[model samples]
Structure formats: C-alpha cells, structure tokens
Target: MMSLAYFNGNIIGIDDPVIPIDERGHQFGDGVYEVIRFYQGKPFMLKEHLDRLFMSAKAIKLEIGKEQEELEALMLELAGKSGLADADLYVQVTRGVAPRNHLFPKCPASLSITVKPARELSHQVRSEGVHIVLLPDERWQNCYIKSLNLLPNVLAKQEAFEQGCFESVLVRDGMITEGSSTNVFIVKEGKVQTRPLSRYILAGITRLAVKEITGEQGIPFIERAFRPEELLEADEVFLTSTTSEVLAVTAADGRQIGDGQPGPVTRRLYECFQQKIKAM
Candidate 1:
C-alpha cells in the first residue's frame, strides 16, 4: 500500500506539507517519537508503545495534549487506511511552533504521524547471523527518552557502515550500553544477560518480551551491565528492537562471537518472538 501522513487531526498524502519552518521539533529537537509496527494488520504491543511514547513526552516536559484512548484510536484508524498488511507507524509530538529559543514554548504542543510500509530484514541475516562494530556511546544521558535528537546515533551508524557492519555496539566507559538503535544481550554459560534499565539505555519493548519469555521458559535471564569484552567473549550475542526483533550478532571487532553463528538460545528466543507476533 502507498504511504500517507496524519498531521495532527488531518490525514493526507505523505508528500503534503504540514509542519512549519519554525516548528520546535525542527528548530530544537524538542520532541519525542515512537515507531509502532504492524503485523498482519494488527499493531504489535500497541499499548506498550503508547505508554513509552507518553513516558518520553513526560521526560521532555512536553504535553501531547491527547488522551491515550484518543491517540490509540487515531493511530489504529491510520494504520487501517495505510492499506498494508505490515507497516510502521511513526508518531511524534513536539513542543509546537515558536521562535528559535532554548526556553519552552508558550504555545500548545503539536503532533504528527505517518504510516509507511515496513522493511523486512533479510532472512539470511537471521539464518547466518550479522557482524557489528564497536563504537563509543557519545549520546546524552537520557537515552531512555525516545527523543528526536539522533545526531550521535546517526554518526555511529555511519561508522558501522564504513566498517561493513550491520550495527554498532555502543560502549560507555568499557561497558555495553546498547546498539545504535537496539538493546544488546548476551548468553554466557547458558544464562542470558543484558544491561539493567537506567538513563543509559532505552529499555526496549522487545527486550521486555524476551526477558519475559526467558522467565516463563526458565531460561535464566539476568539484568546487569556487561562489559564490551564480555559481549565479545559470550557464548552468544543478540540485539533486539521494534523492527529488528531478535537478531543474532555473530562477530564484533573481527572476533567470532560464540561459534561464529546463531546460537541455540538466540534461535529459540527468535522463534518465540515469531509466535508472539502471530498471536497478536
């Protein structure tokens, strides 16, 4: 299906004009955003995504001005109109249009949303695993907030591209924080470990699902910060995100992770993820 845009209360063509040049989101990146994915015409974890979107708005002191039910209704309607079996709905709420300044705007906040076809990662990426590079985590402390400011993340992805890698494993002070746009996890001695929630990590929705799966299946999951070297040395490594899902990270810094292939644990979690999406 072709793409479309939902600017505030109006739905229109994707190329149509909606935002002004003085929009706060454009001027100062004073906004929060969320990417909600649809599977077979149903949104996966719609409630969780909306909750996180509001949490991000609160962290930025921005008011979305719409109740949760209202937002969800509008989003689902847009998704239905998108005409695609699988798509991505991007919603962003900004502090509104105002003159360039660091101070908060006196105007009411504005919202914008768009629905586009989802890009499916190659099955080969999951079957053969993928390589990633190590890059220093130079972003702000409030990584938990899904803000519009992504300059550092963009650069990190660029570094990974130059190195012929799928993503960059971001490290802060010798500890693994996450990937450029994903949450990193490792399997060590048959146990799963990922960094605990903090201002340093985004606390991904997919990460939550994996942990829950581990718990229900008695897989022994641990939430703690593991060093970069530890990730390299783990029996298996993987990254999770809204779109990427459970992707195995085979090699980092030219060194093999585990047996240089997707491990049994990673494969099992990925299968569980598929089941969850199907049930949705």
Candidate 2:
C-alpha cells in the first residue's frame, strides 16, 4: 500500500498535484494542523487530537466546514488505505485559496490529510536518552494554537539539528515553556512538572496522556512553569509530541541532565504509557 492523502475530500496519492499555490496555508501560513499517531492500526488518542484541531481552528477564526464525524471518516479512510503498521495522519485546514492579503480570506476552508509511515524514535535515544539545547523562545504569543505559522519553531529545531541534537527546549523570559516542536517535562525532587496550559505552550496530546498516567499511577505531578536553570537541576527530563511520543533528554547544551541517563521517573512513565497504548 502506498502513502495516501485526502485533499479537499478526495483521497489521492500524496504526490499528486492537488494543492493550489494560492492556498492560504501555503501563501500566508493561515492554517491549523494536527498529527494523529496510530500504533499497529488503531489511531492513538484520535478523539483528543481532533478536539484540539477544532479548538485550534476556533482560535484562528477558521471554519472547517465538515462536521466532526465527516472529518474523522475521511481520516479513517486514508489511514486504512495507507496500510502502514505505524503511521501518522498529517491533517491541516486552511482558509482556502484567495488573492494575496493580510486579512482573512472570504472563502470556504481547505483541508489536507496525509498518511505517512511513522518513523520509530532512535534506539540509542530511546534506550539511553538524547541531548537537546535550550533556545530563546522567539515565536508568537499564540503558541497554544497549532497553526501553520511555524517559522520560529522550524528555525529553532534546525539549529538543534545542526548542533547534532534531538530537540530544542524553548525558554521564554528565563522560564522553560516547551520544546520547539514538543512539550517538555521535568522531574524534580520526585515530582513531575510541566508548564500549564497557556498561550505560551502548545498543550501536546501526549503530554495530556502522561498527565493522566501520573494521576492514575499516583506520581507527583505539578502543572507550573520552571526556570531554565532548573532543567539542569532536574532528576529527569522528557519531551512529548505526536511524533516523538515520550523521549528522555539526558543533556542540554553539552551539560549532562539528570546523571546523563533516563532517570527512573521517565522510564516508569514510558512503561506505563506503553501499557496505556496497548489498552487503547
């Protein structure tokens, strides 16, 4: 089975010339997106992802015309066609095509759903842990919305990529907010902490799942911002996203994080998260 995509309600090969140049998403970065991960064949936390998608659309005043069920059906159809054991549904909705303008486009919305195989996280990183860098958060204030405007994140991640790192933790005003493309968490004094849901961070789906796990397993959890300096002081640090899932950060900016290994808390959380996936 080949990779497939749903463009404007029609399922087609991902390589097809379906998207227009003037699409608001392409021209002005006026769109919202979500990535749904499927383990085996079942999409993990699909409902939660879709709910966030709706919330993101509302944040940007973009109307996705299709009903929720209709959009879900479309994604299901494309995922079924892809036939990958582990894959991601890269779904986006834009303000349709229009002439160049800074204002909102007065047209229906456009949607694109692409299914691609999910690349497994590197074994070295998963088993031991990965190193990351802390970068100043230069993005807009609306990081809560998963919009297509990702130049800042792209640049930051690219810097990490060049530095031979797995990801970049973004700090704003001396506080650790999140990663360039993921939500960050740290274990300090045996307590799990991540920045609270705010305009400063993206509220990753996997992050919410981890939060639920911390509660179900009675792990100490706190939803408050922590300082960048505190990251090095953490006992363990991990990142979460649709693609990265739960990834440990053993170092940042060449400084060892938490004894230079995936600490007990991160490992246990990952194990419980795996069991949660199986139950799903």
Q: What is the lDDT of residue 163 in candidate 1?
A: 96
Residue 230 error for model 1, in Å?
0.8
Tens digit per residue, CA lDDT, model 2, 1-280: 6788888868887889987888889998999999999898899988999999999999888999988888998888889888887898899999999988999878999999999988787788799899999999999999999999999999999999999998999989999999999999999988999999999998799999999999999999999989988888888999998888788999989999978989999999999989998998
Compose the digit string of candidate 1's lDDT tens values, residues 1-280.
7798888678999999889999999988889999988998999989999999999999888889999999999999898888988998999999998888899979988899899999899978879999999989999999999999999999999999999999999999889999999999999988999999999999799999999889878899999998988998999999999999999999999999989999999999999999989887
Best by lDDT: 1
After aligning candidate 1 to the native by TM-score, how far in Å is the CA of 215 from where it should be? 1.3
With a 3 Å backbone cut-off (N, CA, C), the pairs that clash in candidate 2 are none
Give, for candidate 1, the lowest lDDT window spanning 10 residues. 1-10
RMSD of 1: 0.9
Q: What Cα-based lDDT does every candidate model obtain?
A: 0.92, 0.91
lDDT of 1 at 2: 78
